[model samples]
Target chain A: MISARRAILVSARTLQRTKPLRFADPKKIRLREPIVPTHKNFDVSPDHPLWAFFRDGNKTETVLRSKDDLSTDSRPWDMPELRLKSFDDLHRLWYLNALERNRISTEAEVAKEIYNGDVSLFTKLDDNHLMTQKRIKQTLLERQVAYERAQLSSPEEYLQLFEDKYINADESAIAEYNEKLVRLQYAIFGIEPDLSEYNLEEDINVKFVEGLSYVAKLKLGRYLASNPGALELPLNGVMEELPFLVRDPEVAVEEVRAMREEGVSRKLDNIEVFAFLRNAIEAVRSEPEELAEEEN
Target chain B: MKSTSFKCTCIISQHSPGHVLACTSCSRICSLIQFHLFQIDSHLKFPNTNEINQNLKHTIPFYLTAEQSFSWLIQSTLSKCHVTSLLLFFSKLQTSLRPISITSTMSFKTAAKRGQFDLDRYVGNLRVKTYKEFAKHSRLPTIPAPIPTLRKDERLIGEAPIVAGDLAYIVSGKHKGKISRVLLYTRDNDTVLLNEVTKNVVIPKQYWAANQTSHVLEYPVPIPRKFVRLAAKEKDEKGNVSYVVAEDLVFKEKYYDDRLKRWVPRRFVKHHENIEIPWPSPMSEPKDDQYSTLTEDVYNKTHELQTVAKSPFPKSVLNELRNPYSKFKKRELTEGQARRLNAPQMPLSVEQKIYLAKKAQTPVKKLEPLSEEAKDLIGSRMAEHLAKIKNPLLLKHLEAVSQKTTPEFQRVLNEIEGKQD
Candidate 1:
């Protein structure tokens, strides 16, 4: 009644039991095999060696060291002369602060959940730890600011620094953009635009195209046919049809320039491979003398 | 034994040699055979007699005798020696062995101190010898040599009058805020020994430095005679709070003493003989006695007599300006008093509304011809307006009415009748 695979397995097991493979120096020889690498890639990615220290899943259940010994202190250590610390020192402090912040937030969440969200319990349970962590974070931030200020050589540099640190899209503008994106998604999928209690996966249904315009509906239908099981519309084609949803030309141009500078190759649409090769060859041949000099 | 089986290490040609291990087919000789033999010889012992005898049986030719075969075997075994010479010749053939072609390896000479001095040859006993040990000393002076003190007359070398008690302000240098009294004067280097005059304590001889330019100068301000307030306050309507100076409520009058090239009180002259300047006002006033003395009475009488010739200042200003001590004392107003004087005002009474009404009625009075010049201006303006009337509708109506009433209408009718006839 046994299959060939089962028979082979049984015979192999019997053979192994009858005569085990013996090493010349069994005591000296390592019993364990060489460690199998967790990562297959050498370059930067989720599977890279750089991410080896991180957990496999989003839920971080790994608690290092003694959690019971944690205690609260009213006064936190103050580093008023943090600005005097070297770049390496500041970098270390910043990393430590970040680690502490992550630990505190996780701990606080766990504690809150355990106590049924009774926040007053936090006072008894290492509350000062969070406060001290924040203080340390602030100290590190101040040190960074001071260091940056010291490094700045001119008003232009200061302006650039300020832009790098503080400048971002306005909150209201981001909210409006998000709303517009949601609306576009609704229109494309032919779902009723209800932001009050919306869940993208559950709410989006291709069958409900009654609210969508003819062109949008057609685009959605084609996209669905081409890319089955996709929840969102194909952005490029959809954006062309919806002019208002398209990003600013200047911003798009800036993004393109940034990408080009970062060495991202542009997709050569409608051009033959041979023509592309020829153009690349011509460009390489006609490269500027400074680049040639740099090579030398 | 496997002489015929020898293969060339070259991958392209698998040539077997006829006698010597040279590839006739490929027209090439592999020098690797010599290296192979050498490697085998170095790793294992050199092939002994038995191995040689065995090789001879297989490899020797049939025409050769035993001696000849033995010699041939020996030659074959030592064929490497001849091959090496051949290799050397071939290598020489490929590359010219000329002096110019032969290159020597480049080497560098490092710069370093390589010699050591022979101390024994130079001198013996390098250690220094001293009989007196500093640590073994029994007595040590607690203080260094006594400081030399300069004579008073020896210090008075300047033409300008210098006194010991003269106070000087540090006009410049790091010790700027310091005010000191001259303890001793030295005119040789224009230096002075000074004692710092701090509150209730005189730190004697704190410095004895030369009086460089702008270092120390006479405190060039006289003691003020009377205090005066700088800012004036206007009286409020209630009259309960009178006007007072807001800033520097009590200020003293300071004067410069040109002769001493310093500032001092009027009492400074009292120290000098043959000077008859009397101390004035509060300087001579008895501290506890509020009653005016005979000298005060005389001073007041003279002041009053002098005022009779000229208009006197108001009593309020005179009283307030007289005493600086009292003025300073009065600056500390109670919280209630301060609030009453400076708190936000209540809305003005109806009796105070006359000004607002007058302000509102400004246009009425403003438009009125209050003066003869104004009336004349209005009259001229009216005449100018009347003169500017051209092509009026009323004039056109009047002209039409006159035309209807005129004889021209009848003439025109008669002319029409004549034409018909």
Candidate 2:
């Protein structure tokens, strides 16, 4: 047993000689995993603070490829893909992220959407990113309103209503409730929910029929039947089916007159007759007086 | 009265023709002639009187020619006229040839009395002629009145008025005594220059004449001779007051005795006493400002109060004593000492020393003894090297090398030259 113990001691000595002495305590050895040798390997360890940002293999590859392309022997600290665990190192990483985010045209808007969804996450970012996020939210809201206006048939009406309704609202309230929703839908989702998809000219024929409510269709049909001369055949009938034209008094009167000789029964509502007279008088009044005296 | 007896004696001697009876009338006439001749000689003794006498003799002989013995008189007169004219001419010539008179009223007798007889009639005639000539040619108008003489009390017109000495008073300065006689005139006739009568002296135009009632003593009083003499003697003994003279006072007697073996003067010994002198005071004595407290106390107690206990010697003696002590102390080491201290350790190691010594002793490079051709080549090459090198040391080293192996170098140089050719 003494010989066995001596043999064990000799084996332990050989092991100590064979292996490198662990000068660093186990708790102090923070970076236990060795870095991968591949140029594309930009993976942050799970224990690292920046792991969540570059977790995806594709994202890691992209960041590593960019880092490799920008690598230099003199400036290891400047490498944006390098993930360090310290707060100061993380702060540098966030700064680099902010710098890259600003370089992208759409990053501001994307960052705003991210911030609005998770404000605590945005606040965790450096101050520069927080400021950029606010600026981006403002820009996105403006762009969303512009896009919404672009989709509108009558942007003036919507703009007037929007100004009247939201101008009086608190800035935070408008941004949080009204502008946020609109901006999300328009800018982020690229969707205009309030606008119709129908083309004015081509969809005129089916606008009254297709996707119409039963009550609406019945009302429209009965009105058309009683006032048969209100619509001309073929093209006129398509025109009469237009959503805006059907409600227009001058168009109904003209359609009635054009259809009268075709033996179509039609009776004009008193409101329609009054509208027709008012339109005729407005037309006479709106005409240029002697061609506006030639504006010389 | 005895002439008759003499005549009888003369008759007895008549036979000799010199004894004719002498008549009284003849005696009387002869005597009268002798008397007249003596009177004329006496009168001629006066200057210019001899000329007059000679003229009278000539005229008397001419006047006697009209008497009974006229022929005899004529002969005598003619003979005397020659002598008379000769004498009168000499006298007139002498008078005319005189030197100019210095002043009027100088008489010929006075000139004779002065032993100026040669100039006697000359001077007299000159004075008379000058006075006559001056009187005739003078611009001053003559008056019938006699010439007036200036008296002591007389004053000239327009002359400055002189007050009586007793009437004037002294105005300023001591001895401003009353003005007396006018002393000397400095300005024109109008101003009196100095008044001797006023012992203090008044310059006439510069100082106003003093009134009688004016104070006589306004000047500074004269200082006594004793005070001045004492001050001068003191100044001479001490020299002009100076710090060096004052510093010599301490141990002056001892220094004098040591240097000259004699006692110095008390003034020389006490010269420094007057300088910052501490006078013995009944009250508290003032402290000396020159020296530090220790020095002052030592100096005062030692030199000033010899009776006090613990008396120190003078500074000079103290310095003399301290000098030998300082000399006995160890001499200071100079900067070279530090360098020498480090010199032994300068060589890096034994190996370095052996290497350095061997390197120093070894010949750096060697060359085979050259043939004449090789020497000539090297000589030309060295000349070229020397010509190219402007450094004096390099040139000197090359020259030395050339001197060391001249024959081989010459052979090498010749070879070089042959190759070049």
Candidate 3:
């Protein structure tokens, strides 16, 4: 029912943007449009585009599986092979996968509650979804590489390659590359490259950590959250999801600017920290003698 | 009565003062009639008059006159014997104006046995409740959602979910009696990865052959810490001493054994008892929630703001790059670094490539490792050069030119010279 309403809302928005269809006879027009039952109602008019959906016939199946019922073949739809020809196609596919992943996770949480905290059903669902997403990303990365390679033969190859190397690489890679690049320039001028002041290995490690696989990144994030002083990543948001790796500082600057527009106006007053502090003080005051004696 | 002086028969008094006798030693002045009455009631033999006088002389309060002492003695004796006088004195004891304080003899008993001062009473009122508990109970009480509570024995086995690196006893399998260490904790998959520490058993036809194998079970139960007892070291015939773990030892702490329906050693508790090993206090629990611990202030401050997305290049990388030789010298360089260094030097440009093609290149000298001081000097000069070049393109060009080794450069020079000849 919710999906039907959403579909209707989307169609309604599209209808609003364009002209209304003119009927030959005014009497033929109906007052109310037929409602689409998105969640459960599979039976629909044969002429409808979704008629193929009812081809399998009515069968009871939940949108999300419970933890115990999770299996490899539990996904609602199989991800198609990646033969993305263009950037737009890749982008669209990425968006679609992200959308599905979000929906599955959200519905899985609700399903967990409905099943009374038994999340075994969602276990296989997440595994399958993550695998599919990984495949999609691998396809997208291939497409991006191919596109960049194709661009190299173009008239602006130098400029394109320059952007590819500096902008496309992650921030830490760019920094390391930049330092090395500078040293190279000095060498070209017959001057020695200065690198002794910097710890190149540490820099590379930080960059390597930044470039860790998504699963590794999540694991690292969890580890850092539990134990903050784990591997020190370059970014302050070590616990957050991967940030855009663009060479253009202006892009990052603009993003920061946009974020600041929606940022909090007031400083957070941590009542809990203060509350803890106050409690500690009161405890000390109440049992100063005993505490002192214990210390002695 | 005055003519015939009644002899004082009071034990406390030696002589009588007229018809109303004042016993100087007794600290009581009483009528001769009262003194005569006391002598008749008290059956205990009295000391001689002289001995009584000596004791009374020391016992009497200085503030009391001989008459008062004689009267006090008569009153004390009467209160003990006469019901009317005793009732009067008891009534006075109830009032605030009573001459004496009646203290109960309860100080001799231990506090635990003392009825009013039981330790349990105060301690019972002193709860271990925290603010969270106070808040939980203070709210409007609602019917809690009922959850199925498993019995101890039923709960003992896989009651508490097993984690990685836990120890377990295989209750049902090809290796039924084997003790194993948990490897992978896949709660979703009813099977866990385990390495058997005990003697090896033949692989069942249905299972794969290996010392370590993933076994499917009805959720393998974790061996409770209480069941794991420290065993004494034993010497084998070969004179090798080894520590053996004793699982049969009764747990010192009494635990309710559901199957037995009685308090028993914790080891006797059901194999499925859902007992969790008490974890040491976590420095901080991993919290994805915004309201976690001392950092809540920072979390709240950023709550409205989107969390900074992770950056591929963090400033820490730059800091590392700034001091590559220090801190992590033992660590291997990342593959990315090796790739970047080996990347075919970016072509300087179409023009530079053409220009290099026309020139007769000079042979470079054999490379030598720089001394520490020389490296420092070179590093300082490079820092100055880096500071001056803001153009990324120029830096790329440098990277391209610096890719070749001395041998590679020498070959290139030889090729150019051969072309010139």
Best by lDDT: 3
The whole-model lDDT of each prediction reads 0.34, 0.33, 0.37
Model 2 misplacement above 4 A: A1-52, A55-126, A140-296, B1-421
Span of 10 residues, lowest total lDDT, candidate 2 chain B: B29-38
- True-vs-predicted CA distance for residue B190, candidate 1, Å: 70
Q: On residues B232-305, what C-alpha lDDT tens digit does candidate 3 reach at each position?
A: 33478999975444444333466655443335444322342343232112222333422122333222321111
Which candidate number maximizes TM-score?
3
Output per-candidate TM-scores for chain A, rounded to 2 decimals.
Answer: 0.24, 0.19, 0.25
Clashes counted in candidate 3 amount to 40
Per residue, candidate 2 scores C-alpha lDDT tens digits across A1-296 of 23422433343443343333323243443322332222222222335433233324223322211222321211112111221122233334446455543222122222333333222222222333444434433433343344445444433454345444443555457445444434433332232323343223332222123222221233343345556665444333322332322233345455545555675534445345334433433443445664586763
| Candidate 1 C-alpha error for residue B53, in Å | 97
**Rank order (by lDDT, best first):** 3, 1, 2
Residue range A25-141, candidate 1, lDDT tens digits: 424533232222111111123333322222222222232222334433223333543434443444455565455444433333334334443334333433443444555456545
Off by over 4 Å in 1: A1-67, A81-84, A113-296, B1-369, B372-421
Error of 3 at A17 (Å): 36
- Return the DockQ of model 2: 0.00
Worst 10 residues of 3 chain B by lDDT: B100-109
Every model's DockQ, to 2 decimals? Answer: 0.00, 0.00, 0.01
- Per candidate, chain B TM-score? 0.13, 0.14, 0.16
Docking quality level of the chain pair in candidate 2 = incorrect
